[model samples]
Target chain A: MNITTKLNIVPFVSVDSMMKLVLAIGIEQFLTELARYVEEDFLRWESFDKTARVASHSTEGVIELMPASDGKMYGFKYVNGHPKNMLEGLQTVTAFGVLAEVDSGYPVLLTEMTILTALRTAVTSALAAKYLAPKNARTMAIIGNGAQSEFQALAFKALLGIDRLRLYDIDSTASHKCAANLANMGFDITICASGQEAVEGAEIITTVTADKKYATILTDNMVGSGIHINAVGGDCPGKVELHRDILLRSDIFVEYPPQTRIEGEIQQLADDHPVTELWQVMAGKASGRKNSKQITLFDSVGFATEDFSALRYVYDQLPRTGFYEELDLLADPDEPRDLFGMLLRAKQAAS
Target chain B: MNITTKLNIVPFVSVDSMMKLVLAIGIEQFLTELARYVEEDFLRWESFDKTARVASHSTEGVIELMPASDGKMYGFKYVNGHPKNMLEGLQTVTAFGVLAEVDSGYPVLLTEMTILTALRTAVTSALAAKYLAPKNARTMAIIGNGAQSEFQALAFKALLGIDRLRLYDIDSTASHKCAANLANMGFDITICASGQEAVEGAEIITTVTADKKYATILTDNMVGSGIHINAVGGDCPGKVELHRDILLRSDIFVEYPPQTRIEGEIQQLADDHPVTELWQVMAGKASGRKNSKQITLFDSVGFATEDFSALRYVYDQLPRTGFYEELDLLADPDEPRDLFGMLLRAKQAAS
Candidate 1:
């Protein structure tokens, strides 16, 4: 596009285009590269403008806006979680995001973040596992085999070289579907009938269910010493996966303390409970896994910076892959103050 | 559009489309109708969810997200203000917004709000003037013939039948442009050399200069008894258009007092300074223009509900005018829990 047109146009990545881009790069590679971006941003977390996701809660579910800016670029994601949406043949979570230049406050990209969010969340889990999971771990129990299951399975395989999968879901078909999707993607799959059976001999466990209410997907007896827990589902208030007893034994790592305290599994704990920031672990300011015998829990309540990084990564990849369309999203009048003149001219042209 | 396609597509109104929409409806008629929506929403203000705008301020500018929700629908506007942007041939203020169904949290419309915001701001000012301005007011002094000046003039003309405009700006070219734009638009205009000169026989004085710092566009001496002052320029924390003395003399009215106390001309007032919400007056719970000899000030710092009303108005108009394009902005899978399956199918189809 010409520079003049570029000023007014924003690159939009639809779901189809996002999928094409992911497939073109190979999903495993895409997750790995995206994880690197997330990691890089996390390492410099102090430089970002961080705030808790602004949530509007309703009787059924919640919609949230997550925004963050790192001096130069500003990004925000609009997402919703309605547990009952599935009954109406709609996804529990659907999202879209925009990334703009801070200097100009003009959006350069708009993308279907439902898919991108799934990818980023999975990659973030794997990134934490790389630091908190057992050394040379080869087995993982995924207790919720829904939309995020396959991505989590692949991300762990790509990031941590874990090829063994033990999957279980409240719905058997969901587990079967997850196993079938990863059937040819290099995994020894075990579709278990119960959550306990799923975590039988696994070194790592990822809980990612889609219920809006609190439920124990993992009991204390199911989790033993040295196993890492990637708690991904219990993100909002009043929702949790692991039992409170399990949290007492595990060393919890969180994204942002203020947000995680309200949304993460640690919400079960006191506001003053000690927890390590994952960014500090990555920055060497804090330790990750103290020992193999000490259980490590990654209380993953996704933060805005991760989405910002995901958008930045996608923006950088746009020119290389050309997997986007230009959207006429901003007004670019020839003269800044002649906005009325522009409207009059448009009327004249239309006539 | 077909139902299946409509489920995944959001209608987007671009700048050109928005301009066309305004022209097709006629600017005067559009403003009058928008003012009606604003009035309707303001009257039922207690039924809406309101919050102060979330702002990310920088040395060069500030970017904000203003969101509000009625029980049924939700809306948000992303806007930025950069005083230095005008020097770089960019608009000091630019915006876009989205309206979504509260139940589904799915966006139904996305539109370029730069033009729409101008209209709504003007209509909102005129709406306030209808309740607060002197009876049968026909003369308005516009101090700041910038981008917003013409809309302000026309909205008053349409809503309040103001036919005379005295325009002034620090820059004479801006005043000349404002006059030339309103030349044949059914208004008798005067280009004045100074701000004081502009207010000379006007019944309503609107101070709308675009500057980042505190400014005295209207001093205590410049404002007189029984005249209405539409203060629109002093919106952000450190910006003020009228002198403290002027605020002390006027019977102040505001959109949201908590927000206006920090961002509007009332920021200069004491914490205990009393102000009436304009919504209350529109709702007939409070009196407007209590006496003819009293000065009334509509401290117009803008509000999110006005944007919500504007988005609601645009959404209602879309089907009738067809002034929008469908955007593939949502991810829809046959099975809500099978987002991964959707991606996998896309990959297979691509192969």
Candidate 2:
């Protein structure tokens, strides 16, 4: 690229381009490669600047800005979670992100994170399950069967070799939709009538429901002793998926404690409730699963570094796939001090 | 716009389009109108949810995310300030912003804010001057004529009717460039040898030097009684333009106290030192320019609401000007829960 193009243009990955790129790479491989990036970042989590997302809470939902930097690169994701949006035929969560250079503070990539978010979230859950889930885990129960359900199934299958699926949703149509989407993908699938029935013989359970209020998608009685819980949907204050008793029984692992305490399942517990940082387990500083009968929970509210990894992954793919368009997002004057002169010249050129 | 377009496409005002839009409406008139919006927002300042900008500081410079919401609409600007960038033929600052609706939590507009920020910062200064500047101020002195200098000159001309200009810069070429950019724009221009020479016999002195250090552009002795000082450049920590003695002599005005205390010229002052909120003066809650001999200083660190006003103004201008392009930034699946299904269809369509 020329100097003007280099300064002025930011490569934007649109929804269409993201879909095309994912399809070109194949979804399972994309998730697998993305998981590696997420795992690598998690292992060195202390190197990043991490903070609870800055959220603007309205009566309807919340809009958040999640920012992270690993000293070399900076990234932020603008995401909105409006559970009611689905009633109006809109996605419950929509997002976009930017990744920039720490040296110049210039954005190198802008991308639609709606699809990428689903992919990263699922891969993160599977990565957690890799250490926490029971050995030779084969069957998984997905209790939401919504937009994130299929990705969860695929990510588990890609990373852990789990090929059995049990799906349940409040609306059976959602379960059907998820199962239909995953058809012929080499998984044994079952659409269950209820969350309890779905987790009957499952070794891992995922609750990915969408609601803005307190929810108990899984109770203590429903969860067995050894099942690893991937709690995906209880990501905001007053929004949770598992029962307090269930959380009390499970060993919770969180991405960031300050954030998870306020927005994750652990919010149901006291402030000093003990939880393990997932990074420590990946770095071998802490143990993941202690025994066959120990229950583990990955309280996944989604952190900024995961999104950073996703952005970095997509930015690296830009040259190989060429699935992005250049956006004229920044002002680049020939002379840096002559911004006003640039305008004057533009006027003169136009006239 | 169709439903799909309404949901997926955000109107993007690029650098090229922003220049075109500004030229379409004369620059003076644009500044005047934009100043009106800034004034209106300031009039209802209590309506906004304000916070000190979120900044990520690097050894070289800083990048910031400034967000504001008035319960109905939310807006944020991503800006980076790197003073060393000019040497590499890059802008000292570059910015872009997003304006989104609160009800649905969907972005309505995404625009390049490099030009818009310059416009809004200048307009905000002029708006503050309307309340605090000495009455009938016709001649203005502008020191450090860099990228922001010409806009500052034009804004003062548009809002305060200060037609006589005295410009000075360490590098005289910048002053000449400022003079040349403003040629035949209804101004009596003079290139002065020093800041003291620039301020001689002028009612208003605007110090807008670009440096990321604690260099005083204006000394206490140079600032006389009855003069209004518009301090614009000392915006971040360790960056101040006016000497502390000049600040002590003047009744200071600021955009937001929490922010201005740390980033504005008043960072040199005690934490509890009295400073007037510009909005209070605009809303008739506080006094401005109590007497002709009393010094007044408008310490502008640039705030989120000003950028909000700028984004709102540009969004309102979209239909009339049609100067923006639609960016497919959001994912809008036909069925909200069938995001995977949408991807499947895309893959099938591509195949």
Best by DockQ: 2
lDDT of 2 by residue, B1-351 (tens): 222257789888999999999999989999999998889999999999888999999998898999999999999999999999899898889999999988788999999999999999999888888888889999999998999989998999999899999999999999999999999999999999988899998999998988999998998899889999999999999989999999899999999999999999999999999999999999899998999999999999999999999999998888888899999999888999989998999999988
Best-fitting candidate, measured by lDDT? 2
Query: What is the DockQ score of candidate 2, to 2 decimals?
Result: 0.86
* Per-residue error (Å), model 1, residue B120: 0.4
Candidate 2 chain A, which ten residues in sequence have the lowest lDDT sum?
A: A1-10
Q: In model 1, where do residues sit more than 4 Å from their true spots? A: A1-5, B1-5
**TM-score between model 1 and native:** 0.98
What is the C-alpha lDDT profile of model 1 across A1-351, one tens digit per residue? Answer: 222245678788988789999999989999999999999999999999999998888878888899999989999999988888889988888899999889878788889999999999999999999999999999999999998999999999999999999999999999999988898999999999999999999999999998988899999999989999999999999989989999999999999999999999999999999999999999999999988798999999899999999999998888889999888877777888888888878877877
The runs of at least 3 residues in candidate 2 whose Cα sits more than 4 Å from the true structure, single-residue gaps closed, are A1-5, B1-5
The CAPRI class of candidate 1 is medium
True contacts kept of 1: 0.67
Cα-based TM-score, every candidate = 0.98, 0.99
* TM-score of chain A, model number 2: 0.98
lDDT of 1 by residue, B195-227 (tens): 889999899999888899988889889887899
The DockQ-derived docking category for candidate 2 is high
